[model samples]
Structures are given as structure tokens and as C-alpha cells.
Target: MLVLLPPSETKAPGGDGDPLDLAALSWPELTDVRAGLVEALVELAGDLPAARAALGLSPTQDDEVARNAELLGAPTMPALARYTGVLYDALDVRSLTRAQRARADRRLAVGSALFGVVRATDRIPAYRLSAGSALPGRPTLRALWRPTLGPLLAAVDELVVDLRSSAYAALAPVPGAVTLDVLCERPDGTRVVVSHSNKAHKGRVARLLATTTGEPGDVVRLRALLRRAGFHVEHPGGTALTLVVPADWATR
Candidate 1:
């Protein structure tokens, strides 16, 4: 089973690993595109104003642009450790056992704007780029990624659980991939889509899937697995699973 996660806007800076190496990444087919994007980012970084505007960053976020400037030479860290936010915080990767860590390295992959997709253990440097960012002379990220990334993900044989946000998911959609939705159940019996804490829930789900001994081969089994793991999972038909959390719990 493969679980596709969205990349976080905030990343942990500084790493002990060597500098970026495109060839060492999992999908060698993406090496050219990755190199091109990295070069584009480096060039863009030279023009701080343009880079800030293109990346939707504020004046104070110039450090983020600096990170992009050093993309090629910056130290690297595993993709899982490089990403930080509510999602990664909830995943709590540091607490996992060796066996569970190995499983996570094998089953988890992150959707990246610059690298396309990387395995959990793939060593990557700190860089700032969002799915919606439009570099000066490059095609829209969706246009650049879909043609290649779409086919690659579609060709994967294992069951894919896609937990990417709409923006990243639009870059390269996985056909027949099972998706998840987080809902908050109010006391009035009405359910509202979770927004603020959605990632945390997905992170927990990913953690459960990563550490479990079972591999769900399809949406049905996936739903069963989540349900067995104590999640309030609902299959409202189709390939999407809805996980309902109490309104009070969601607010926290």
C-alpha cells in the first residue's frame, strides 16, 4: 500500500545529510524536471521581489527565498523529517519504533512541487515553493507535473491512499486512488467539513496505516482498516472515506 501525503509549507531547517542529489531520489525519471525546477528557483531567488511575489511570501519571509537560493548546496534530510507542521507534529515520527519507521519509509511518499514526489526516506533540502506558485518562465505546476506525474502514479500497482490537499492533488491526480475527508459532527447531528485540523487527523490516519501490519488492497479494506483502528470511518459511497470527529474534539 502507498500513502501519498502533501508537503508542508513550513519545513525544518538544517540537516546532517549531504547536499541535494537528484539521482539519489526515488523516481529517476523526474531528475531532469527536478534539476530544471531547482535551477529556476535558484535564478528566481536572485530577484528577491519577484521571488517573493511568485511564492506568495511577505517581505519578512525573505529567509525562505534565501533557502531556495541555496537549494543546490544546502544540507539534506529525509523528506519525512524535513517537513514540519501540524501534520508532521501529529505523525510524531520521532516516537516510532524501528520496525514502524521502516514501514513508514516504505509506504509513505510526499507530493512536492519541486521534486514531483519523493519517498519518505528521500533526502531533500529546504526549499520554498507551493503548488500554486508560478515561476517567471515556467509552465503552471499543474501543467508541468500532470503529464508525467499522473502517468507515473497511475502505473503504481499498490493501493494508493491520497491525503493531499486540493492544490497539490490537482498537480498530479492518481486515478482510482482512495481519498479521505474529515468531518466534524456537531451536537445537532449535522456534519461540517473540517478545515483547520484536517491535516492532524490525516496525519494520525497515515501513522496508523504506516505502522499497521495489514495492507489494505482496496478502498473497502482500507475503510475496514481505519475503522478497526478506532476511526469513525464512513464510506458514503465511491472511493472516498469520511472520518467523523466530534465538534468539540475538532476545535481543540
Candidate 2:
């Protein structure tokens, strides 16, 4: 099974691995596109104002632009370790057992704007880019990625659990991939879509799937597995699963 995760805006810096190598990444077919995007970012970084406007960053985030400027020569780290935020914090990869870490390396992949996607163990440098960012003189990221990434994801034979946000998911949607929705059930019998705390829940779900001995090939088994793990899972048909949390535990 392969679990697709969204890339985080915040990343850990100063890796011990060698500089970026497009060929060494998981999907060799994406090397050309990755290289193009990387080059575009580097050029954009030369103009700090344009980079800040394009990336929706403030003056305080100048360091992010600097990171992009050094993308090509920056040190690299595992994709899993490079990403940090609410989701990665909840995944807490640092605490996993050695064997669990190996399983995570195999089962998890993160959706990226610059790289398309990277396996958990893929060594990558920290770079500033987002799915919505529009690089000058380049096609829209969705336009650039969908044709290549869609086919690749569609061709995956194993079960795919997509936990990407709408922005990243639109870049390359996996056909028949099981998606999850988080909701908060209020005492009034009404359920509201979760927003703030959603990533934490998804991170926990990804962790459970990554470490489990059982492999769920389809939605049925996947639902059962999550249910057994104490999640309040609901199947609303199709390839979607809804995880309900009590309103009291919900974040606005």
C-alpha cells in the first residue's frame, strides 16, 4: 500500500546528505520537470521582491527565498525528516522503531510542488514553493503536473490512500485511491467538516497504516483496519472514508 501525504510549508533545515540529485529520487520520469521547476525557483530567488510576492511571503520570510536560491547546492535530508509542521509533528517519525522507520520509508510518499512527489526516504533539500505558487514564464503547476503525475499515480498497482489537501491533490489525482475526510459530530446530530486539527488526525492514520503488519488492498479492509485502531470511520460509498470526532475535541 502507498499512502500519499501532503508536503508541509515548514521544513527542517541543515541536512547531512549530499546536494540535490534529481536522478536519485523515486520517480525518474519526473526528473526533467523537477529540474525545470528547480531552475525556475533559483532564478526567481534572484529577485527577492518577486519571490516574496509569488510565494506570498513577508519580509520576515526572506530566508525562505534564500533557501530557494541555494536549492541546487543545499544539503539534503530524507523527505520525511525534511518536512515539519502539525502533521509531521503528529507523525513523530523520530520516535518510530528502526523496523517501523523502514516500513514508513516503503509505505509513505509526500506530494511536492517542486519535485512532484518524493518517497519518505528520498533525500531532498529544503525549498520554498507551494502548489498555488505561479512561477514566472512557466505553465501552471496543475497544467505541468497532471499529465505526467496523473498517469503515474493511475498506474500504481497497490492500494493508495491519498491524504493530500485539495491543492496538491488537484496536481495529480489517483484513480480509485481511497480518500479520507475528517468531521466533527456535535451533540445536535450535525456534523461539521474539520479544518485546523485535520492534519494531526491524518498523520495518526498514516502512522497506523505505515506500521501495521496487515496490508489493506481495498476500501473495505482499510476501513476495518482504521476502525480497529479506534477511529470512528464511516463509509459514505465510493472511495471516500469519513472520520468523525466529537465536537468537544474539534478545532474551529
Candidate 3:
């Protein structure tokens, strides 16, 4: 089976002299890193039609055809993310071309800055529900994506997770609606805005924060293994320790 990998720069890149280098890097640089993602996607799956569907696209996916057409010649984040969305669309699978996978890996290894969004619209409930990172001072933005595809999209959940970065990138379509918007605002302000803007339907999101009940060693090993198997795993913040395995590793 073909195992997909994420982009490498997802983790906050560190240079001897430039800790903020990752932040200052231009969109083109991010695009280069995104290209590597397509390379990995190609290695794992050769069928474009299949890949497109898995990323949550339909046979009538004419809209993305030209948008990502340039990707055929060069690997880039837009091309790869667009392609990944197509694959997830068709396959009913959550596939990250390179950037998302890489970012997920980083959050798993080293600690990461994440923003949380809630379900609501206009003068909504507070979104900084304890786990939210305070914003306004620190401006970290992340792309939001649906972790599952297919009829799953019908379930309706968006902004399942928000990754914190220097610049905000456009996110994939909302699981059911288009709530994830891209802008660089302070962290707290961003969360508040997202929380207040989008509406939510309960019981749709994956339990990434499920708590770990197993021994730390066992949990760590399982998490590492899941990552090695090429998945963007999530933790359900509990003692039970859940692993959201990628479709490719479902049998293994």
C-alpha cells in the first residue's frame, strides 16, 4: 500500500541564526515545500482520479482542474493541497499532501501553537474554552481542514483544528460550510473571530483530544508508530489513548 507523507516545514523550522526564518519565508518558499508534498503523494498513489476523490472532490470536479493544473509540471502547496482535496473527495479519506502532514508531525513531536474555533455566529459563546491560546499579542494563524471526507462531510464539522504559524494560509473547504477564513490577527482575536463567526452542529468532529489512559511508554510508542505509518494522528485528551489511523494503515 502507498503511505502518504506531510510537508517537512510544518514543524517550526529552526536555523542557527534565524528562528523566525520560517515566519519570514515567502509564499513561494512555502510553495516549494508544498511541491515536495506532491512528490510524496505521487510516490504513494499514481492515479490522479483516485487521489482527487480521496481529497473530497466529485467527478464533476472541474473547478479545481485548472487551479491545480500547474501542479502537473511543478509541485507546489496550492497544487498539492488542491490535489489532496480532490483525492480526499473521491476516496472518503483524509489525505494531506505534504504541508499538513508535516505540520501535524511537528505538533506531535515538539509542542506547537494551535488556535481553537467554535460553532456559532454573531455575538456567540466564548471560544477560548480553557484550551484556547490567548491572542492579540501573538499572531499565529493556521490552516483549518476537514480530517475526514466523503459522506462524512455531510456530518458537518469545520475548523476541527487550527495550526499556529506566522502567516495565515487559506484552508480547505469547511467540512460542511466555508467558515475557515485566512487572515493574520493576534492569536486570541483570531480564535474569538472564528468562534463567533461560524455556526456548529454537534457530534461531527473526530475526537483528536481524547485522553491517554495507557502507560506513557505505550502511548508514546503507539503514537510514534502511527506517525511513522504516515498518518496525521490526533489525540483524544483522555486516559484511554485513541489513535486516528490513516486509511492506508487501517488494516495494519
TM-score of each: 0.98, 0.98, 0.21
Residue 194 lDDT (model 1) = 69
lDDT of 1 by residue, 122-224 (tens): 9999999999999998899999898888999999999999999999999999989999999999999998886766988999999998989998899999999
lDDT of 1 at 145: 90
Q: How many backbone clashes does candidate 3 have?
A: 44
| Greater-TM-score candidate between 1 and 2 | 1
Q: What C-alpha lDDT do the candidate models reach, one value each?
A: 0.94, 0.93, 0.25
Prediction 2 TM-score vs. true: 0.98
RMSD of each: 0.8, 1.1, 20.6
Error of 3 at 4 (Å): 26
- Candidate 1: segments with Cα more than 4 A from true spot: none
Q: Rank the candidates by TM-score, best first.
A: 1, 2, 3
Candidate 1 TM-score to native: 0.98
Enumerate residue pairs that collide in model 1: none
